[model samples]
Target: MDRLIVMKTFVTVAKSSSFSAAARELAISGSLVSRHVADLERQVGVRLVNRTARSVSLTDAGTRYADFARRILSEIDEEDTALSESRDRPEGTLSVICPKWIGTLDLGDAIAAFVKAHPLITMRFELGGMSDRNYDFLERGYDVAFHTRDLRDSNVLVRRVSELPFVLVAAADYVRRHGAPTTTAELAEHQCILHPNDPVWRLGAGAETSHHKVQHPSVVANSYLVIEKLVEQGAGIALIPRRPAVERLASGDLVEVLPQHQPPARALYAVHGPGGHTPERVRIFLDFMTVWFRSRPAAHAA
Candidate 1:
């Protein structure tokens, strides 16, 4: 078997996690796909995939090899493109991944506008589907990943894109009925809405900061947008990202609780594999996103 072909096939199988799916993607037979993987495994003298009757998953060796293979293949493709055309202009496909909530808001608009402006670059914006595992995007064929929290990985270049400020808000009707919580300590007694990741709401800045463990949550949700809706209907108090909550707060559909307690703005980051060999399109896209987000109305607390 050709080494390049085997490498490509193995990478496809690793990504799809199924022989049949990889075959379909490659427009080949499942047995042929299996043979390529087996040949590659024999060449490497390691079992790349741990195959069972029901499922196929990469082994520890397979996991590391997949990363190398993806980078090698990507570099090869880039070189091929470079040889045929001038590498001065950014071209080729750039894949990005972000959380589902960001995709539905202004972030989505920013991405769309970016793609529209960069006609040469093909955009593959994957909305959500990030696993709980660390830096899963690298093995999953993504060029870049966006995250709100600071990533601890040393292998990737992390850039602070923008500040995602959030406000703890509730509906006027609910505030009237439940009475407002005047301080962070008082929030413990109120019917708070919990963000699955941020169960403990940290409020205020610097030395004045306080952490309030969400107590008596009437609802728990993963999406901030969904939390905003629940808060609007007088469900419970929620900490909502300012961009999505601005209009509602302005219209009085929601009222900020304890406006004095300004929570530190959540840092939104653009993270990707180490920058040295990173493709030009990926770099440009990240820069574009940062500038676009910075221009938007920030800190929507009135």
Candidate 2:
């Protein structure tokens, strides 16, 4: 009764020119094969076969229909094979999104390396413009979204990519002018540049951890790069991700404040839609990013 089954039976019968042969080839009963051809003919409103005492042959309409059917079946097979291969092979366009700052630094380098290694995979990497709502990336058609914070969404899936280190930095000029805070309590007296979303800086690790809320913010900006620049200009002390600040720290442009007390590291996460089977492209990319961050743990130290 299924159209594809009937089409297949008719196609086989057309090739063999015998219902018995088609039944034998398809491993069905001869009557079923005859019924399949009859159903197909009735659907098309045309007699598709001519039977003689010794042989069977296709009618004029049957010959044309046979050709179309064969082509359609062939295309269907090709499409099925392609889809199956895509599930196993990493050979498709992978759309990914992340925060603007992370996408521009070490994470960007990892993605670039992945692109070079897997020539079959086409990647679309976007920076910034991430929504506060966690699952928004899935609706926007992104295959993966990177996050610096932990996400607890039932509609989405998450993997721990790496732990990102946060460093409290101030310019050499600022340190000379205000003097560095030797203890956690002294930080209250210093001018701080704060990200509105991250007003409290969690210092230390484990039980020794302490939270310091920004008491006097000289400048408030959402962009970490802008905050880094402001910190370099001696505007105020700020806590920032260490990856982008690596070069500046090495060049002595920025100095760490309260060397004994470092801010707690945050986990970097890769978020995707909830599914038991992750696409090969997205899976491979997530694996690569995890390794990339793991290899650069030194840069993550505050």
Top lDDT prediction, candidate number: 2
RMSD of 2: 3.0
lDDT of 1 by residue, 256-275 (tens): 89889967677888888874
Q: Please, what are the lDDT tens digits per residue for candidate 2 over residues 1-302? A: 88889999999999999999999999999889989999999999999999777667999999999999999999999999989888889888999999986776578788888999999998999998899999999999999999988889999999998887889999989998989899888888989999887888888888888889887788899888799889999987899988788888888889999767888777889998888888888888889888887888845443
Candidate with maximal TM-score: 2
What is the lDDT of every predicted structure here?
A: 0.85, 0.88
The TM-score of candidate 2 is 0.85
Candidate 2 Cα errors over 4 Å, as ranges? 17-32, 50-57, 86-92, 152-155, 273-277, 298-302
Pairs of colliding residues, candidate 2: 100-128
Clashing pairs in 1: none
